[model samples]
Target: MGAKLSGGGGSKFHVEANSEINVTPFVDVMLVLLIIFMVAAPLATVSVEVKLPPAIAKPIANPPKPVYISLQKSGNVYVGNELSSLDTLGDDLKKAIGARNPDEERIFIRCDKGTRYAEFMKVMNKLQDNGFYSVALQGEDDAK
Candidate 1:
């Protein structure tokens, strides 16, 4: 056979750049990372046994129903929803508080925003005159 300088139809054989991405390796790497994280996740959260001391404190009793005093913008006073004038406020408060010690029981005061400071002080004076020293001011909760 005669020596050929180049292979026949060599121009027909050409190399082209592959535009498609090879995702098999990427999928393999991701699967390996997933397995690694799965294996390491449980080991990361190791809990230790804690020895706590015995609780010796006495159980607390149920709290008493709170007593509320409402002062209206109309200058009317209320003791636990019962309408009362400032003249009878002390007696009404005592009756509302029942046999509970006035010195220890807390009396909550809620008032209309339009109520005057003088009117509020009048209710306070009535409570103080009745020997009820534990008075708490009630306000609307803003958390809601």
Candidate 2:
């Protein structure tokens, strides 16, 4: 006979050759879990389809052109139809927004899906720093 270590901080593993293997209970539990997942996986998901109305957006009657900026995966910025550098975007957007009347329009930001979180936050911070209060986020509506 040999001495064995039990459960403790300084314990080590020891085994007796006569120790019977008990895999029946383990297999039983695994089978139950497999069956449970098989039954629950389908019912766990509920699907519903929603319909949306198709209509053109009514543009603001009398307002200034909205100051818009986007952060692309490549980190390119767009003010209008032209691309801009990040270094000058903040100043340029500030000046563009300032040129408009107070009640004319607001700034809008469009972020691409692949854009990094830090980059998006930096763009938002720049917009805020440029004194843009009414900032709108642009996104596509789910065509449900």
Candidate 3:
């Protein structure tokens, strides 16, 4: 026999074991992160603004591979077809570029693959100390 007798009131909770997961908090967090990044993106970008000098685009039929400055295998300097001393290189570069374009905006440095790092830096100092900003390092590597 089954007998039922009830006489008291108490708190109770009924939970469904098969209920779906709630993702509202996750979605809200992602939206907040997206908005934060949207606000921060523009503020993170910075640039060194300079008053650019006037220039003209001149067409070169051959381009001549630029006026190459080279560091010799014997740790010497060469510009164009002339051998120059380290003491005179900076002045010589200025003179060479002045003869062609006084306001030289670009330069190309071609160093031997076997050249020392010190030698390479010395060559860079020659360019940078004289106010040349645009420079390119050119070399070709063997196919792997």
lDDT (Cα atoms) of all candidates against the true structure? 0.86, 0.73, 0.74
| lDDT at 140, model 1 | 89
Candidate 1 lDDT over 62-115, as tens digits, reads 988999999889988888879999899888888887888888999899999999
Q: Score residue 54 of candidate 3 by CA lDDT.
A: 78
Worst 10 residues of 3 by lDDT: 1-10
Candidate 2 C-alpha RMSD relative to the actual structure: 15.2
Which stretches of model 3 miss by more than 4 angstroms? 1-65, 99-103, 141-144
RMSD of each: 10.0, 15.2, 12.7
Candidate 3 lDDT (Cα, 0 to 1): 0.74
lDDT, candidate 3, 54-98, per-residue tens: 788777675433666888767988877788877788788777776
Best by TM-score: 1
**Considering every candidate listed, which one attains the maximal lDDT?**
1
lDDT of 2 by residue, 1-144 (tens): 333345445526544344556788899999999999999999978587678788789876876567778778888888765677667776677566675653445778898999998988887777666556577889989998
| Clashing pairs in model 2, backbone N/Cα/C closer than 3 A | none
Question: Could you tell me how far off, in angstroms, the CA of residue 37 lies in candidate 1 after the best superposition?
Answer: 25
- Superposition error at 71 for model 3 (Å): 0.5
